[model samples]
Target: MFTSLYTASAGAIAQQQGLDVTANNAANVSTQGFRPDRASFSDLVHTGVRAGEDAPKTGSGEKLAGTETLYVPAGGLRQTGRKLDYALTDGRQFFAVRTADGIRYTRSGSFAASAATNGRFYLTDAQGGLVLDRQGRTIEVTDEHPARAPGAFTFRNLDGLRKTGDNYFAPTALSGAAATAPDAGLRQGYLEDSGVDLADVMADLIQQERAFQLNTRMVQMSDEVAQTVDNLR
Candidate 1:
């Protein structure tokens, strides 16, 4: 009886976690460059049980051991007709300005000239940070280069790119070293759209909600059983 109660409790907790992740994914369905997160669950340790003279059996009690984050990168491209808006074509991630705090990366091509004293143009992700140029320096475009074509951009590998939030990506050791030159062509007058699928997300949300509700009922039933057993004593 106690084992059943534990199993029910675990099921409820795990279902709740699944619902939370689904909700978050649904909320960010339209966020640009947003990678959807999935929850992976593992079963807890099993306790041994004995039935009559038959061989020992394992108790059915189980709980959610833990969860893993599944980062699924799926986004689309959108055209903005803005000169600074850019997006990678082959899963390539753009490098951005780095600070002492840490290096930031992004896929958002929306950029603007920094109003700082230096008067340098800064490439910013959705959250707005400086974008790095081929020279490993912050791109400072002036009116003269305002309409310059993206002819010089390069990268060692595109898949090794890491997420830095706000539709940005940063190169990781897995991504290899930055290319000595920018080889990727920049597409001005366009923006990248989020890869998330709203229909799929909504479906997932509904499934998770149902699962959570089922688990809640299971836990409640288990509690009633436990109470009845206690009263019998």
Candidate 2:
């Protein structure tokens, strides 16, 4: 009886996390270069009789392992006709930028020229992070070279990257070192739309809610069974 309670509680927690991921995806439906997250789950320990006895095996519960970014192309590219707006043809590629917390990577290409200081303008992202070029240097759009493009970078293991908000990603040891992608095609006058699909998000939201409710009911029933045993004693 106690094992059932534990299993139900764990299931409820996992479903709650699933709902959160769905909600976040729905909220970012219009965010440019946004990638939707999917929750991953793993079953806990299991117990069974040895030597294939008549007893059946039972699992303790399941837990949310983590969330994975889809990293797939969104609703295609939209023509913004803006010189600074850019889109990468390869969805796995990213633009390298220098942020306050060192170098970071992002898929967003909506950029602007920072205010001129010392007679020079630098390409910056929405959050004013300096954009880097293929040589890992801040890209300077000089009058002589007005069509400068940002650098494209990729990792060996994309699964090792973690989202750092603002559509940026930070690499983990598993991701290996970032490398240049010289052949990464860039569109100068377009932006990639968010990868979230409202219909799919809503469907997941509903399914998780139902699963959560079912787990909650199981917990309630377990408690009632315990109370009945006490009354009998």
Among all candidates shown, the one with the greatest lDDT: 2
Error of 1 at 64 (Å): 6.7
Residues 97-156, candidate 2, lDDT per residue (tens digit)?
Answer: 899998999988899888657778888899999998888888777552434688889999
Candidate 1 lDDT, 109-213, residue by residue in tens: 666655446666654444455566655566656662542433234357655666555554566787776554444535666665665577877887788678667
Pairs of colliding residues, candidate 2: none
**Model 1 lDDT vs. the true structure?**
0.59
> 91, model 1: CA deviation in Å?
2.3
Runs with alpha carbons beyond 4 Å of true place in candidate 1: 51-74, 144-165, 168-186
lDDT scores of the candidates, listed in order: 0.59, 0.87
